[model samples]
Target chain A: MADPAANGNTDSGGSRIGRVPAGYWLAGAFLLVVPSFASNFVMYQIFGWSFILGMISLSLMFLAGYGGMFSLAQMTVAGLAGYVVAICGTSAITDISQNWPWYINIPAALLIAAIFATIVGWLAVRTEGIYTIMITLAVASAFFYFTRQNYVLFNGFSGFNGIFPPQLFGVDWRNPIAFYYLALFWAVFWYLAVLYVSRSPMGLALQGIRDNPRRMAALGFDVTLHRVAAYTFAAFPAAIGGILLTWQSAQISPGTAGIGPVIDILVIAVIGGLRHPIGPFVGAFVYVILKSFSIDILVALGMAGERFQLLIGLGFLAIVFWSPDGLLGLWAKLRDLNRRDPLIGRLVRRL
Target chain B: MKTRTLLAVLAATFLTATAHAQTLKVGALATLEGTYTALGEDGMRGLRLALSQANNMAGGREIEIIVAGTDASPDSAVRAARKVVEQDGVELLIGPLSGSEGIALRDYSKTQPHVTFINGISGAQETTFVDPSENFFRFNMDGAQWSAGLGEYIYNVKGYETIATIAEDYSFTYTQVLGLALGYCAAGGEITERIWVPLGTKDFASIIAALPDDVDALYLGLGGGDAVNFLNQYQQAGGDAQLVGGTIMVDGTVLSSKGDAKNALIGVPSSGPQADTWDDPNWQAFVKAYQDEFPPDQRFPSPSLMATGYYNATTAAVSCLNEVGGDLSDGQAAFRSCLSNLVLDAPNGEIKLDGNRQAIGTNFISEVVELEDGTLATQLVKIVPNVNQTLGIDPETFAGFGVPGRDVPECKSSY
Candidate 1:
């Protein structure tokens, strides 16, 4: 049987980077210097949003890819962190916000989100396959409704606006350049961490459990403990992304973590490719670019701007139809073709 | 061949750049997606009509409007606003149809001092009341201002001494309820119960059962689908309580809703920014212009309140451009000054800004009545002129009532 879950995954963390790939070096350099030429909108709205979204989706990838848990509550965990920040930190809703310092609220938000995720994991882990998705979706839906209805804390339908980033190092952290670097740093940190963890013994054990839970249990591995731990680990990146997202928008509402966004994070993870660490970021960049420019594209094509959703849906279907593993899988197939058919590959390369 | 192609490309780029410099760029934002799509379409129609009246020329420059759409989420609104301001480089932004979107944009306006923001149908009280932005101007009345004269009309004319309220629980509806409760209680009226329902509620069985039977009327502060749903279920349950409609409950959006339940809305007294059948010449002209501008199939018989709000905002922007000769240089200081003091003779009424740049305009108390063609429309009963954000109460006294919420502005009479 083809191991679809483990497809394209290679190496353990102990196998260190033997001769770092040229693509990685080039990508790193390009990202570091992007702000020099990019406009404030590109840096702040496009790249900054992508990095935050990528980090959240990366948390999902870490679960579905390494631990075989496809939890939809990742976005809810992120949203919970954002809500904690708005409630604890300063916001325009003077009556509701406590106006605590960022130092107190930031850590508090992370801890609360992590704890919430742990509880959700404990409940969701008992279910397998499709049931897990249904359970996570239910949790996410409950959070959305609760936040919408509870005015004393969550501020009901309107929620909270004007929740700006605190000034750090004499810089408005929400400034386009500053926010881009902030989001980029967190995204990269989580990316490397997930990559390293996936190769570790813990990651292998989780993968074994994913393949056969009974076999892993028979082999003396604590399958449930590892699955729950994966959720806790995933929450950190999602929480950090949530904090950055709230800071970027300067507001948090029930719609921020509503059913729409919860599904969007999953769509982002799956489209980028679940087999590797870089897949989610690739998917996120595509998604953000499409969202930002779809109006112009539709208008240029002589179509109504409201049809952008149709375009996105079509693109999503095309990608999924041709490459079941996602864009990364498509790229891998192209590379394999180049190696297998030397004459045709050389002629195409020459052109 | 390559040299000729390159030269042609350079020439095309130069021609486009020069053409762009001769035109003025403005951004128009609306919730073109999600639940408020119909409202947003009307807002855009209002904007286009105003632009067409100006012949798309303001000051000495040709006006160029860049349109952006949002899903009514604050995040999407901000991103759309940022793209137009930072990427497309618009001098002024007119937009954002939802309440929360307005509050978020008001904060965003603080970050962009050079770009002026004109409110478009966002009736959130806090948008201008709290930490108001200097460059942001709202030409439409807030939710509280829309509730003017409704309480007195209900108590004195309708002989409703005791009433209960059923409102969608949100900031905007809270402001409306606060306005009604304060006005009614001050006029020797009493409120027996207040039931706050979440938006998008489908069932009204329990709510109808829980309503106090002794109350003379039930003040409905719900809007959109919630209003339609409640009315349908309430009718099925054989509800006979006299209805006092909120500004939105009797709006064309709900009146035009498909169902026989809307018949329950007939003779229901309500108050809002404008009445559909007002005989005022300006309003008649506006209605004619709106009908002439778009096909009958595409628009309602009367322009929606959202359409009126955007029309007023666009008129202010366009006239200011004329006053300043379209010169928006030096951080738009001259334009801002002209806008702040300029009185707008809106189709509904004469609108002027208060100290916070929020509109102190007119309100109309009306009752829903079916027209000759069997279409429902609000007929004018009373006109409340120059109603301010504070609902005519003294500033200190109004502040004492605190921000609008579940129990805010206390329903009981102080006397």
Candidate 2:
């Protein structure tokens, strides 16, 4: 009989192995500590944003990479969480709201996001791959304009702003570093937890279904249940990321859930080498860094930075043509080279 | 053969590189290369003139005014914002050319706290209302603030009993209608109905299908491309609606983008610091200088609103910088304090940033008239200065004014 633990993930030696490769945890730990030595601006701004976005992309990885499903609504899901935070609780303030304490509003917002995600998942999962994408895309588009016109709900175009984070542990997490650590803390916890879940029997069943849903169903696996669970699991990360985004920017609007941004999540996952737990982080890192410098390169070429997409388009095309596996895959090849170079190792020892 | 061809191309390109690639980086993220690219280019020209006038030196900085024309997409706006913040090394930012862009660009603002962000007419009201870090400020009147003069003019002054809200469906457009309705409602008037169409909607038949004939006045929140369609269709469909627009409804630049729709629109636009306010000889001379530097089509009439926004927006940022001069560490407190306590002279008149850090400035109510040039024009008739008066509320206060929020809808549009 097969083991049910770690979602019943076992090696030939009969020892349980985690869903995430061990390297992923090491990388997460490495990233967590880098902020300590980094500049406040780097730690607070660039690194913090990367972590926030990484977490969001992590949810996408959970859905698309592991579960073999692609839903555009994860970004929308996060945005919904952001809107709830801005409009519901203590963060709701005098602008989006006049009353509400932090404790009451945040959980309410999170719960609302999860419930909405559950409903969306149930409806979206009713259809297969491409249909799920289309349905979620439709939902996202609906949310985008709905927030714009429904004055009573979204306050029309003005959108809710000034969504303040709680002074958790009596520390003002609004500080860039504080926010950074908060993001890092959440990211690490999820990394560990998801790693655990992916190796579990449920994870294996989900993977089995991904390979051949009909066979998995005949084998007595609840295909529908597994898909729903994947989406629900994905929603937890997306919701946290969205809530963090709201707190980070202190605002929420239709712009957060717009189509362009929704699609970019796919781009991030594709670019990060969508093979493992570390892929989302790698993708987000490159995306942030690419954006950080794209405008300057454009300006140097006498092109307006505002129109930098013309240049970025070329870079994206190059990446797709040259390395289909993305930056992480390229890094792996380079690491392989380093391993094979005896002279390099001898030189390293001499140094 | 392919590699040889590549080498030849690389060599050819390398030889043509500029000797001194000294780029003057003027940072802008206007909607210039997409649906609203024309408007974005117009904003770029506005800043170009300002840069040329200053010889590209302001607060002792020389920039090439590097542009990051957005496709009027929020994600594109962020890409543009990143360009300014990281690549162009822009001391400040000027636009995203739309309300949604403004909202997202402001989120990017936190990522580059040292770089000041100014709204380029992304008048969603929420941009600088409450979530505004000291880094982000809008010079131009917000969507709600622009319509500050409308309610009184349409209802109290013109004595219209009921009005219908017809606008493009989006936050900025929707909020403008709401602001007008709020103003009208506060003064004991009712909005007959609210009809919203998509931003690029070419036909208004569906939305126009619902207008009750009882409305004596029509409140227009339609803008740019959608405005032209709305007006063109409203007239063709024989909707007997008298127009009272939110600022850009009758703007010359907006008309330029629509090509022929200039002839169909006639009304009082209530966005402030308009060109007619330059009726004073001193300001007229500035106009004459502006005219001499650029062709007629290049001249922006609504500099009354836009330029004032840029000036006030920059001033707000600088005030914070001045207080925290040479001290980047505690810049946050000084910025918040500077913003909270500022009362500056904006070209639109005196602008005071309320407790919410939103500016209260004079708004103009201008009539659309035929100029001698035979072009449709907005002639200044009245100015409603400081529409907010004493109401110092932020976006946080503003959004929660009525009801609760629902689940933000998921994206439904396919790329």
User: What stretches of model 2 exceed 4 Å from their correct place?
Assistant: A1-30, A93-112, A149-156, A329-351, B1-41, B58-161, B167-191, B194-205, B235-240, B266-272, B275-304, B311-364, B371-374, B381-415
The local lDDT score (0 to 100) that residue A202 gets in candidate 2 is 79
Best by DockQ: 1
Question: Which candidate achieves the best TM-score against the true structure?
Answer: 1
DockQ for each numbered candidate: 0.34, 0.07
The superposed Cα distance between candidate 1 and the true structure at residue B399, in angstroms, equals 2.2
Q: List the candidates' TM-scores in order.
A: 0.92, 0.73
Task: Write the residue-wise lDDT of candidate 2 on B196-254 in tens digits.
Answer: 66566666787777777787877777666777777677777876566677666665456
lDDT of 1 by residue, B33-52 (tens): 77677778788889988998
Q: Which candidate gets the maximum lDDT versus the true structure?
A: 1
Checking candidate 1 for backbone clashes, the offending pairs are A13-A199
Q: Residue B186 error for model 2, in Å? A: 10
